[model samples]
Target chain A: MEFPKHLKYSREHEWVKVEGNVAQVGITDYAQSELGDVVYVELPEVGTDVEANNTFGVVESVKAVSDLFAPVTGSIAEVNPQLEEEPELVNSDPYEDGWMIKIEMNDPSELNDLLDVDEYKTFVEEESK
Target chain B: MAEPGDALRRTSLYETHVAAGAKMVPFAGFEMPVQYTGVIEEHHAVRQAAGLFDVSHMGEFEARGPGAAAFLRRLVTNDVSRLEVGRVMYCTMCREDGGIIDDLTVYRLADERYMAVVNASNIGKDWAWMAARKGAGVEFRDVSSETGLLALQGPRAEAVLAGLLPGGGDLGAIPYYGAQERTWQGKRVLVSRTGYTGEDGFELYCGAPDAPALWEALMARGGGEGLKPCGLGARDTLRTEMKFALYGNDIDEATNPLEAGLGWVVKFQAGEFIGREALLGIKERGLSRKLVGFEMVDRGIPRHGAPILAGGRNAGVVTSGTMSPTLGKAIGIGYVPLTHAAEGCEIAVEIRDKARAARVVETPFYRREKA
Candidate 1:
């Protein structure tokens, strides 16, 4: 339930760590925990453009399928290479090695609409209850 | 999911599940555990070691009196007349038009008595179907509320079960599809050799009040044996790997055994049974659609309600699907036109509105090596 202070989050449970023009994206630890044992992650290829709040990929657990929503609109610069063979990393290291994509931000100001760590924590608490 | 005012039923193991930190969800009108540690972990536990499941929500009914065997056979598609005492048979009870009512297992509990284990969701409807068809020489009893069931399934199921029996002799005496009357702490218990998972296992039926103790004793004995308390989530993946037809998903009121690849259970030779004529007619006319197992050739995972695509057009629909924990790949069951149901037949599943390459393959998706 720890939301890293440096990362920005969305109500859909995605996290973004923006450095300059590129934003690194992945599902939060809380998201991975709720959808247990992620067996497959279908991600958009590099260079593909994605829009804010739209589905960019699908994360499948053993019993359920979930959409991975884009927290910020951008073009995909790079995708995680390890996830194709080791999707379990999403559950094992959701914040680091499980980072899904790096987005070249189309509208950096969209970051204003996303939640900060504290706001995301409050959202998770209320949604779970 | 239920309405705000609706109350879901709880099994006798409810407290134990909660105490073990299980994730609970609504299933068949009961607040049942969907997972404990995790679905994939439990699935592997069942495949490699052992897993215990609280199947108490399933219903049990007993029919007694003279000619009960004959009466029972007439209600289902299988010939129960040949079932010896302590033996069990799997079959489906179908409507007059060959539509499936529910698939169940019948146990010959005594010379003039037979018991049926049915899906929990269909308890009331199944009971009414049976009662309406009861003839003069048979008396029926619903023991569902008074009974509790637990399924211990896996490769090590025998060892785990034998440890709990003390000096009860070799469990090998109970062959597959066999049931023996026994006791747990001096209460009547019926142990049957059967399971939905593709593994050697046992299903124990006991008095509802005895369930808590029975489960605790099992946990105590099996904890060291790598026994994980499994839930409906793992249960689905396990059964899906075996290609077992779940009542609500794979087969339902609108589906027939002949078209669902369950024709082997529809025996017409032994005697007259319900749906015999309709099934016979279906067989003679040939099935227009057939249930087939398919695995994705590409990345996407197919799921229930996903359209089955053949020749770039909608041909059928997926009934059940999952990324198998054991095989580590996406697999699903779907009904496709007979023209596209052959092994190696090319088909596609529409995943997220896109056609994903797939092919029909032989089922079951996974089978345990014979001991």
Candidate 2:
């Protein structure tokens, strides 16, 4: 429910924090809560090329499995190694320690296609209703 | 996934489940709660303390008449004649080819009457199957829509039930698989010391109209003792930990009782049942494949339909798998070639496109020590 003003979100509920040419990606708090008790996180290997709106990995909960979609096109620079041993981090701290991958943006202009904080909040509210 | 407009059926406790913030999902054509607080929390509560579940979606059928017992004996694999009044026996109904129709529990309410509780999804199918085989002198009644069932399970079940239905003649005296008729808040209810979870528990069967009131009473009375309201998610994990065979998952029409490791319930000596001849032949010919329990020696959890491999050859497929809440590790049940089904045998489970090392182990992965 908490959509931070500084982050951009995708329709699939992933959030991206933009910096100078580099961006950090993780699923939003809403996404983590919807998928309960995450048991395993499968991430793409580092140095892999990931395109915007494509699946980069899988997130598995006890009851279901969901795809982790990339919000923006990029070349993966770093993958979250901590998730391999403790996937519950995604449930506990989805924004900070649970950041899945860091991407060197292919074209920062793609950020304009993503939803801002207010728009993402409205999207979540309407989708849930 | 069920369509959004599929018109899922609701149980009598539907409102109560919603009010408690349960996550409802479409299961077996019913809108049932998959979890209340959380699956793991509810699972641990039942293992360490107690939990209550609304199992009203299950079906109940009544067979009554002078020939009721005999009619039932012809359909199911178990010996229904051995069940005394106020006792229950786990049984399986199979086709003529030895394929299981459904696994159920037959309750002997009286000398000339019996009730069979079956899976919710198999109610219509099982009803038609039994009705087509009905003989003279017996009346069949489909009482499923009018009945309500609740399972209060865990180690502390007896103490909690004693508080609600006081002076019920020492409920502890009711042995496992035993049933007794008792009055609860003015309604006659059937109380049975039985459960799907491998624990000391009791199931309460009553009229549909009293379901809401009974659930409320159980929660209010047992809440102090940490009896959490559980859902189907925990029910699944608990049963999987015990390696209990689930109907559609572990055993289906394509699988027979002899190969599914349910031979103990098929009493061949008890005489002429629907699948007796085929099962007898199967027993004589030796099993081709066997259901075996396995635990992951690697990381990743195995899921339903995952292929089991022995030396890179397709051995079988996983029927049921879960991250056991009690054992804190991944475990599963699957069928494999008879030659590869022994304990400590090595096999790999295909998980996420990679074969993960797993070892065939003895069931039940978890067991509560008798106190």
Candidate 3:
């Protein structure tokens, strides 16, 4: 699992990369590995308001379906349209091309409540145990 | 995750599975591998080449005596009397009310000896049902714990398995649904040309202690041929693509064989069986709900328990579903009203609160060419 220090992580196994008022959201590497082979990704519509820690979408693998929670409160500015055709990108490159949605942050301060790389790593370790 | 304190049972190949980096999960009381490498990779391996699977968790029972054939004939919906020695017949065991007890395969080992392989989850229940129906001259034995089964499936299955037999017996002599005794590592084993996946495959049955060795030997010999070790996940997807009815998902005690589109297995000419009267009545009354195969005409994937809609009204529910790796389309089996079960009928599957458009289609969605 690669946890980049520059990004913020959520306990739900999602990572957030914030720049100015816009933030990019995607599942962490740990999440994709746990999900095995992702076959479909159901994304929220663009411009949909999502609250922090609330479910905004669903990620379906071959065996199970999992909820994708929002890391911070915002409206979805854009959804990666490429996921519609190739959901495996979420498994291949979860942090880059697999980025799910872009959100225009409603409260940028909400990012502080999210875990840093070190904190997220500790959380993952504890959960696995 | 397999916790040490959990009461999950382990199969004979548990250590082998662990050594191979399998992800173990509790399934039907056994800690079984849900995946080894990945579902898609393992699935394609079975389709294009061959895949090995440890299906030891499934239950097996033997009936032997002078009246074994007679005793067994009254249990299943299929005509077991028609089953010749060295052949197998797929059938459903049902309660008197026409509710299915379990879908099983009956293998005629001899004129006076037979075996019934049942779903692991229904082992205890099915055993009790059979035992209660036991007669004076037949004997019953639960051989599930002592026996292990492995499925070697796909296009290249014969080539791979033929390498394991010492004298290199002509495996082609075993026709589909045929079973014969063979020697493996000096131990007599039963090899059946039957599988849930619609592929050219053989199911090998042996003593529990011989399972790991058999698995290891086959893997070592077939590794170069791309014979990957598959798990229940791939087994499920492959069977779903073939439209094979799973016991719990597709045909449970509440769902009769007729309603599940297994009427072919119900032979009225075979005389009285457990569910004969009820099934005959059902046939006379016609079907209200029928299980039909459908493909998503829209974007979303249909999942188990998803409500099916006909003309925007609640119709039925999805029983087994998956995004088929081979077909590359979202496909599912569900019980819809007879009116909506017709092929090419437009329907909607409620997926994650959204009604996705779909259409009823012909079953056995994926079939391999006869070699």
lDDT of each: 0.92, 0.91, 0.93
Q: Which wins on TM-score, candidate 2 or candidate 3? A: 3
Give the runs in model 3 whose Cα sits over 4 Å from its true position: B1-6
What TM-score does chain B alone reach in each candidate, compared with the true chain B? 0.98, 0.98, 0.98
TM-score of chain A of each: 0.98, 0.97, 0.98
**Candidate 1 deviant stretches above 4 angstroms:** B1-5
Best by DockQ: 3
Q: Which ranges in model 2 have alpha carbons more than 4 Å from their true place?
A: B1-6
- How far off is model 2, as Cα RMSD? 1.7
lDDT (tens digit, per residue) of candidate 3 on B84-110: 999999999999999999999999998
Query: Across residues B1-371, which tens digit of lDDT does each residue of candidate 1 receive?
Result: 23455688899989999999999998888899999999999999999999999999999999999968878889999878889999999999999999999999999999999999999999989999998888888989999988999999999888898898857436888999999987667788899999989889999999988998999898999988999899999999999999999998999989999999998888889889988999999999999999999999988788999999999989999999999889888999999999999999999999988899999999999978887
Which pairs of residues collide in candidate 3?
Answer: none
What are the DockQ scores of the candidates, in order?
A: 0.79, 0.66, 0.89
DockQ of 1: 0.79
Clash pairs of candidate 1? none
> What's candidate 2's DockQ score?
0.66
lDDT of 1 by residue, A1-129 (tens): 658999999999999999999989999999999998898999999999999999999998887889999988989999999999999999999999999999999999999999999999999989999
* Residue pairs with backbone atoms closer than 3 Å in model 2 (clashes): none
